[model samples]
Target chain A: MTSAFWAVYLREILIMKRRILRQSASMAVSPLLYVVAFGCALGAAVKVGDRSYLEFLIPGLAAMASMTQAFAIATEINVARFYFFAFEEFQAAPVSPFSYVLAETLAGVTKALYAVLIVLIIALLFGTRLNYGPAFWGALLLNSFSFAALAVALAMLVKSHADQSLLTAFVITPMAFLGGTFFPVDALPAWASAILRFLPLTHAADAARAGAFGLPPSPLPFIILACCSLVFFSLALSTVKKARN
Target chain B: MIKTESLKKSFGRTRALDSLDLEVPEGELFAFLGPNGAGKTTAIRILTGLSFKDSGKAFVAGVDIDKDPLKAKRLCGLATQNVNLDSELSVRENMDIHGRLFSMSAKERRERTRELLELVELWDRADSLVKSLSGGLKRRLMIARALSHGPRLLFLDEPTVGLDPAIRRRVWSLIKTVNQKGVTVLLTTHYIEEAEFLAGRVAFIHEGRIVREGTPGEIALEVGKWAADTFQDGVLKSSFFADKREATEFLAAAPGGGTLRKVNLEDAFIHLTGKRVL
Candidate 1:
């Protein structure tokens, strides 16, 4: 990578380091609450194919956390653009648009990985030890890459800081709930399941649950996620190039 | 060194730059003087490679900006009108990042950061969070950061817009010090006195065109040495004279009393374009 890419990435890392403790706490809260509210409420009495519902919920939460946290980088980008005006600093420098998008997307991936680590710790405390083989991580990484690239593209398209919240509400929030994170998509009607299959998060959650359950890995969801990552990354590059103009 | 020919840019139906032309020699403190929406910032943005022009050619330090923008950008440093520093980072971190973007070595970045911070007299505040500093300190840091890469050309766009008079004068001295060290400076400001005091040459831009360009003294001389101002029906009008005696006589015999003073660059702009820069 170029030094300019590292410079931009280093800046994001430095800011993250300064807020690590608070960020970790924020990342840990919702998963812990979900485990308490849903796991304590329905886990012992429910079973999906002979296992407790808590075991099923853990991987789904992990998938959801990866998507949400990776997409959270948009808030940081919006703050830099609207409040601090720091995006202009990059524009005035010798950094290329591709280098800029790559660095920011990787930074978003780093944040997602950090949030996933918190979910893993929460699962350990709940005594839910699911399989964590290479396939599980590969699916998770692709999922994070896809959402982070999407976040960078959407960030470039937002007009104001407040518009960022609208994107989260309209795009990300709906996907988080409907992408089979809370329940099995197969339980839904055939039409609903078919439509949900189009969402990248649906493939991510399915692949993650399959890996965590020690099932044989299927390549379809991974392929879908890889395609999503490529498309979103290309969109990020084009939007950033337009933003510079 | 910088040069542009027939530069044109439009936003929807509004023209931001219209056949703009400019030339700045190496090591000269050149200023673009214009009011708001007069294309000063737009021209600066295009020349620095931050924005593209519609139809034009621009060269920075002999490198075509459109052909090799990275090379052209590497030769210039820009301090925008707004305070665009990262408020969460320390003063030192901000400068360090800028140096790294220019591919400076760790050791080079360290040495340059110290040199620039000390030059702006902010070395003691290098570890302070940018948000914790006063506005004047933040402005000084912006200038210091722009010079971190040791660029051949420096662009300051309204560097003292929100500063108090005292702080503004301090920045003026810093700018002068930077230029004296052999770095060419291109400054854009609507403050007529700022251009008069700091720039070796001044260009008056109105509606995206250069109306007048010359040394401060040479431009002021075009409107004569003296000016007599008169107010009638809530409208202020000014007349220029080659001699103070002529101005005083006109002021004394005028229908209503008027103020007489030596002419400045603003007077020359008003005389040439019949518009107030402020």
Candidate 2:
């Protein structure tokens, strides 16, 4: 059983990697358009506060790239399992359900990591003026893993592939906007700020910005993010149990 | 090596298996013959420990499937009806991964993979991608994968449902070779000829019940001699099989017994299930 668990995990990683590579052309093209259009063209016309709009937009683009890919990876993994082939091979294998879920989560997180790295390299090459250290990388990884778990948990609860697209519109897209990826939560009304504070990505972006600028994240927000991650991980695992049953 | 006592399973409003009892010796080729949607796959899943039984008990290789599924699964190999091989991997890579799942070391995996590949006549295409192989080659690869870890018992569901006649016969020959190696084989198929040719003992299942169980010839004999009738003018003529002496005796005594010929498993299957074999 131990060997079976590790074998499945390793095999899952390779499968995910191949899938990501298949989408690599799109990944490369889409991000270039976003960075070039929003950062170069729009930056020439608009200024946010005293900073160049392009400079301010670079961080958000990085965060958006990470968050969107993370969600895509998590959601597609379960969708493939349930709707495509029904995981017939894994179902017939000796591996346990817990091990299967763990492997999937790791695979999703790794795919998100690949997306983040590709986008970051592009951002750097285009002279997007990013100043962040290892601390920023650490926060990005944490945010990706936590969000991947949440996405997978939600995906498991849904019964149809169409529900995934619905979720992006109703849940994921709103979180990105409200999470302060593109604008500061404080710029919104008081009630909106209060609501946005509950989003995991808000805390993640704030922590990332703080670390990148050599500032410290508020301890309270850090605790909140950690607690939210734990909750998401637990929910993901519980959903796996329901799915297997 | 396998036993099930009043095994039962239900899927919502449908009852898949009900009070079914089965026993297979350590090394026998047993076939489960049934019509489509007749609970064949459900029963096979329970025996393989891949699904739960609503009630009763199932044991494979002395291990209770529900209580010790891991142990039970380790003792058996399963080939599903749908082709489930990873299309992205080569035949050898697929076997290597299967061996790794069984905890075989890399060295052992290579050796066992070679042996199984040769056993299936797929050694020449070991490095080719599964998607590039012909249907027969892929099916052979699935068989080799199932035996990669040297499992004592193998379970196959609908092993030859969609193959051409030539390929089906080739697969049957391969199955005979595997059985000759002393491995216990359990298979379910709608093809009566395949079962009649390869099965040592056969079970006729219909509506979640075992209608009859025995050697194919035994069941055929017990079902009584069958006859086909034709009409000539206003009279009906029939032909069938009976003992040469019995035919003479019947002819001398009463005229209604009719002529007899040997009955095969297909006739027996139709008699017990009352369903035509496709």
lDDT of 2 by residue, A1-245 (tens): 56776776666665565565666766677667777887677667776666676666655655666677777865556545654342655666676766766666666667666776777777788876466776566666677767777786887788777777898888778887678776778889999898998887777777766665566556665677667668877888787655542
Tens digits of per-residue lDDT for model 1, B88-165: 899999998999889999999999999999999999999999999988999899999999999999999999998999
Clashes of each: 0, 6
Candidate 1, residue B168: lDDT = 95
Assess each model's interface with DockQ, reporting 2 decimals per model: 0.83, 0.42
RMSD, each candidate, Å? 1.3, 3.9
Number of the top candidate by DockQ?
1
- Kindly provide the TM-score of model 2 when superposed on the true structure, using C-alpha atoms: 0.88
Show the colliding residue pairs in model 2: B240-B259, B240-B260, B240-B261, B241-B260, B241-B261, B242-B260
